[model samples]
Target: MRFATAEIDGAEVCGVIEEPFFHPFEDGVDLLEVLRSGELVAAGKRAVSRAGMPLDSVRLRAPLRPPTIRDFVAFEEHVEGVARAVSGTGVAPEWYAAPTFYFTNPYAIAGPFDEVARPPGCRVLDFELEVAAVVGRGGHDLGPERAPEHIAGYTILNDWSARDLQSAEMKVGLGPAKGKDFASTLGPSLVTADELEPYRDADGFLRLEMRVAVNGEVIGRDLLSNMGWPFEDLLAYASRGAEVRPGDVLGSGTCGNGGCLAELWGRPDRADPPALEPGDEVEMTVEGIGTLRNRVVEGAELPPVRPATARPRDRER
Candidate 1:
């Protein structure tokens, strides 16, 4: 089942999609409510029995506003490709010790068809093509083997980036913060794990093809099966010494070698694709999930950050 939140009659309603239309649930206005009620299928059935609004008649929103979002670099090719272009290096050895991730701002979440604002003062804006798992069941200290059941569904994730700001910040060796605090896209709709069962393999990886385009020209493509680790391991690792709760989102970072403009950035030998500017459209598609689309637009003005004044430190007591 594909669960969604859409704007109907200027009001947002949570519902299920049978395609060509979206059947909104009778009682809830938020998808999180349905998850908490533990009536996913029942709610969907109720929605389907009602009169559905035509898909084109309503506006789509992020499936749910996640409680937390952990974005991970799960593909080796994406890391290596970007690394080689910038530093002439492959992935850091530390990357192999474990699946590393960074907690991004959940409040910055945008929907599939929304406008993605380029961070104020940003020029090298880029888009990452990936998939994300939405936690359905909550758990603590879970093992990889048992983590699969905790995932409710999957959706397209676009970890929109400001490469220039990211590079400057990483020089301080602490963050991707302000560079990433702007926006990240998730949706089209949330596809339940069962809907993706046929694409799952014995190896625990989903065999879906992911592709991304800008203004209709294909920029990158990859197979979800190429991940260095599966979603199960990612969830297990995420839950270690912590709780993996419903509405928590886990993103599978950039897809492959050319998944983003960063892959072509700074490589004089390569024909660099132009960075995104206002009005540029991006579309991402995963074989089982529907297409997630967005347009780039000028961002709001950013107030200048004050520079630190040099001051003497206090003597050790």
Candidate 2:
């Protein structure tokens, strides 16, 4: 079953996406409420059989405002390519030891069809093609074998990036902060895990096709099976020594081969696409999930950088 959060007649509600139409939950119900209720799949089906409106009549929002967002770098190819592009190095040995991830701002998420502002001073705005798992059940120190039970569903994720800002900060040894905090997109709909059971391989990896296109031009394509580490492994690592709550989101970072401009720029044989500019539209699609679309627009002007003040002690000396 697929679920979505939408606004209809000035009211926001969670609903079951029945193609062509949306079957909304009772008045005042939202996706987060449904997720925390732990009855999404069954409730969604019940809602679908009741009254609903045409899907085109409502505005979509990020499926839900995740309580926490943990995005992992689990694709070796993406890591290798990005490392080469930014620092002229190969994948760090440490990356293979364990899955690593960063907690991004959950408040800054955007919905499908929303217009995202190209961060001020950003020259190389890029998009990461990813798939995210939304946690349904909360847990701590979950083992890899049990982690799958906590996953509620899947959705397409676009970790929009400000490359210039990211480059400058990481050189100082601790960031990806302001550069990434600006915005991350998720949505179109949340597809329940059971719906994807058909695609699971013998090794338990989903063999789904993933693609990203910018303004009608196909820029990246990859298969979900290309991920070096599976979602269960990433989730298990994330739950270690910490609690993963309902509504927590775990992203399967950028996919392998060519999923973003940073990777494309590193490849000598492929011509890189121009950096994202105002009015650019980005669409990311995952096989069992759906397409998440966003338009880039100019952002508010940034404050001027302040100059450092002179030290009084040095002047006196």
Candidate 3:
């Protein structure tokens, strides 16, 4: 069943979708709690039995406020392109050994149709097209074989990026920090994992078609089956020394090559899309789960931090 958390007439509402409409839960209901009950399908059916609100009527929001977000680089081709563009090298050997991920600020999430502002002093803006899994069941030290059950649903994720800041921070070797924490977009709706089972293969890969567009022009496309590591492995690895609780998100990084402009940089084979600007709209769609869209908006100016003064080692001694 498809579920959504949105605003209706200025109040928050969580609902189950029945195509053009969505059946609202009570005035106040927690989405994760509903998923954990293991009765989402039944409740959804019951909700659909009642008259519901039109999907176009309400404003969409991030499906849930995730407790943590682990975004993994799971596609080899994507990394091959990005690494070459940024560092003049091919995919790193270590990437093949295991699934690696970075944590982004979950609290900074934006809604499907929300406007994302270019961060202060940021001119090189980018967006990543990804699929994120929402944990329904909690677990620690989960094995890859046991991770599938933990996924409550799937949603389209846009890990909004500020390339200029990201590049500078990575050079310092610690963070994507202020570059990434600014905003990440999720939603349209949460699709229960069962809905995607038909696309899963014997190798456990999902053969869904993923595509992205900038202002209605399709710019990149790839198959979800191309990922080097699956969500199961990502979740398993994420749970290694920590607990993965309900509402935690695990992202299937940028799909194939061309998933983002950073990946296409200097690639003669692919046409470079213009940098994202205020008023530009980015839309990412994965077959089975619907499209997630966001608009770019001008950023608010921020006060600058004072730079540190250089110190001489001899003087300090």
Candidate 4:
């Protein structure tokens, strides 16, 4: 089932996507509520038999606002490419020892077709193509073998980035904070895990084609099979000493090779493509899931960054 959230009659509701139409749940519940109730699959099935509206008639939102977002660096090629580009090095040894992730702002999530604003003072806006698993059942200290059961569905994720700010801040050993908190996109639909059963391999990894394009021109392409660490491993690792709750989202980071300009810039054979500018349209597609398209727009006036000034100390007489 392809689950989605859409705005209709000035209200946001959850629905099941059926190609040219969307079948909203009869109970008028939203996706987040459905997930928290542990009734996503059943609710989706019930929605299918009801009348649906034309897909073009309504506005779409992020499938649901996640409770928390944990984005993991699961692809070695992406790590190596980024390291070489930014620091002139290969993958860090620590990366291989365990799956590493960072918490990103969940409140800033955007839906498919939403307009993303170029962060203020940002010149090099970039996109990281990824896949994310939405948690279904809450768990703590889950083993790798059991983590898969907790995943409710999957969606395409674009980790919008401000590369220049990210570069400056990381040098201070702190954040990707402001550089990333501005906007991140997800959706078109949330595809249930069962829907992807056909693509699952013996290792429990999905073998799916993933690609990204800007203004109709393909820029990056990869297979989901290329991920160095599986989602189950990442989830299990995430659950250590913490709870993975319903509506929590876990990202597969960027795919291998050149998923973003930062990675492309590092590759010897590839020329850096122009960074995202206002009016640029980005479309990311994953097999079994769906295409998520968004446009970049100039943002409104942002708060000014104040200069740091030391306070004058009282003169000691």
Candidate 5:
């Protein structure tokens, strides 16, 4: 079942997307509530037929708010490419030994069809196509053997970045913060992990086709099988020395040769960077996860920046 959280008439409610129609759940709100109550299908069905409710009239919001954690993992090519961009040579060995990431504020998360404002100081805006796993159960020092137990489902993530800010911050060893903290887009819906369990092969690699488009132009494509470390390993590694909890989201980084500006555009000396300008629309899609669409607006008047508030979950051993 595809689950989501949305706002209808100023109230937030959980929901299930059934094609052109959306079935909104009750006041409990959020994917965690639906999963914990085992009422996904029942509540979804009721919302579709209830009085004063219009399945086609409500607006969709990020499927979850206050996600316990948000992890960016899964793309090896992106890691190598990004690392290369930073070092001007080869990747470090340590990046492979552990699953590393920066935390994002789930409260600031946006949804499909929302307008994403470019930050005031940013001149280069880029979009990344990724799949993130959602945590269903909380765990500490989780082993690879028990990784699957903690997974609840999956969804798409648009790791919007300001190339200028990210480049400057990385040099200081702590950043990409102001660049990334501005906004993050997630949703369409969460596809439960159970429904996708069959897609994993014997080698434990997931097989999903991904494609990304900017203003209706295709720019990136790859298979989930290409990820050097699968979601299970990421979960295991992330939980090693830390804690993980329900409603957390672990992103599959930018896919193979699939990120904007960072991978497709040529080097700094040869050509101009591929960056988003005002009015550019970005749409990202994964096989099971639905399409995530956002329009870009100028950042001439962005408000004072706020850092991500969610704390890090314990990493897996």
Candidate 6:
């Protein structure tokens, strides 16, 4: 069942399913409580609703705060293009030896359908569709074969990038931080790995259907299994000699040939670029997980909060 966390009346709450099939499990489940339980929330233990509120109405929060760690561009094509676009080269052999990443401020995470204002200094904003894995248990230095056991569930991650800023920092060999970390959006809800099993394809790829629409026009589409660097390898490699814990998120990087800018806009080191404007709305979706829709407004003020009493907690029957 899919679960979501939202803020109503200044208190953030976990949403569980009261029933199933209205987009998987619309029952309200508490994410933090479920992770800490060490066992899946027993079926019939929570409530769900299909006729629930529209995703646009709720105040979304990060699915998990203080996500253990964040990984970057794992897809060879996306990385190859990014490198050639900036440095005029292809994949670095060093990247394949071990997984790599940058630490994002977990506090900066916003929620699905929230309004994302353009950062004051950024004229170019981009959206990336990545499958994020949430750790269910903690472990360190685990081998690739044993990696799947540490997974908790999956959620949509928008690794929003500031292209102009990112291009400038890579010259120093130590960035994508100021460019990437400014605001990373996660959620709608965290769906346990067990729930994703049914969507798996014969090729061993999770058949998590995904699409991105800009201003109601479709811009991106692909299946989750097409990823070259699967989540299992990222987990195993990332935890090698390091500790990974529950509530941490690992991004699958932007899908190869699936990104609007990374693939469609250019061919190999030679093409024009698209810049995000003040009123553009970028919406990314993964079937079963739900949609993350955000509008680009002038980087000005954060949206106001909605009242608590107005949002009633629906419980499972």
RMSD of each: 1.7, 2.1, 2.0, 2.1, 6.9, 11.8
* Model 2: per-residue Cα lDDT over 13-101, one tens digit each: 88899988899887787888888888887789889889788988899988889988999998899998898888789999999999889
lDDT, residue 213, candidate 1: 91
> Between which residue pairs do clashes occur in model 3?
none
Residue ranges of candidate 5 with Cα displaced over 4 Å: 35-55, 266-273, 300-317
Candidate 3 structure quality by residue, lDDT tens digits, 84-170: 778888888999999989999988999988888899989999999999999988899999999998898899999988988898889
Cα lDDT listed for each candidate: 0.88, 0.89, 0.86, 0.90, 0.76, 0.70
- In candidate 2, position 262 carries an lDDT of 92
* Per-residue alpha-carbon lDDT of candidate 5 for residues 110-150, written as tens digits (9 for 90 to 100): 78779999987898788888888887777899887899877
List model 6 lDDT by residue over 180-291, tens digit each. Answer: 7667778777887888888877765677777877788777677777777678888887787788877778988887665656555446544644666778888888887877
How does candidate 1 score on lDDT?
Answer: 0.88
Residue-level lDDT of model 1, residues 1-317, one tens digit each, is: 99998987777788988889999887645788777667777888888998887888889999899999999999988888788766888789998889999999999999989998889879889999989999988899999989988898999999999988888888888869888889989898999999999998888799999999999999888899999999989999999999988889999979885788887663557757889999999999999898988999998887977888997897875
TM-scores, all candidates, are 0.95, 0.95, 0.94, 0.95, 0.85, 0.81
Over 4 Å off, model 6: 18-30, 43-60, 268-273, 300-317
TM-score of 3: 0.94
Evaluated at residue 216, the lDDT of candidate 5 is: 93
User: Any runs in candidate 3 off by more than 4 Å, and if so which?
Assistant: 36-39, 269-271, 311-317
Query: Which 10 residues in a row give candidate 5 its minimum summed lDDT?
Result: 264-273
Clashing pairs in 2: none
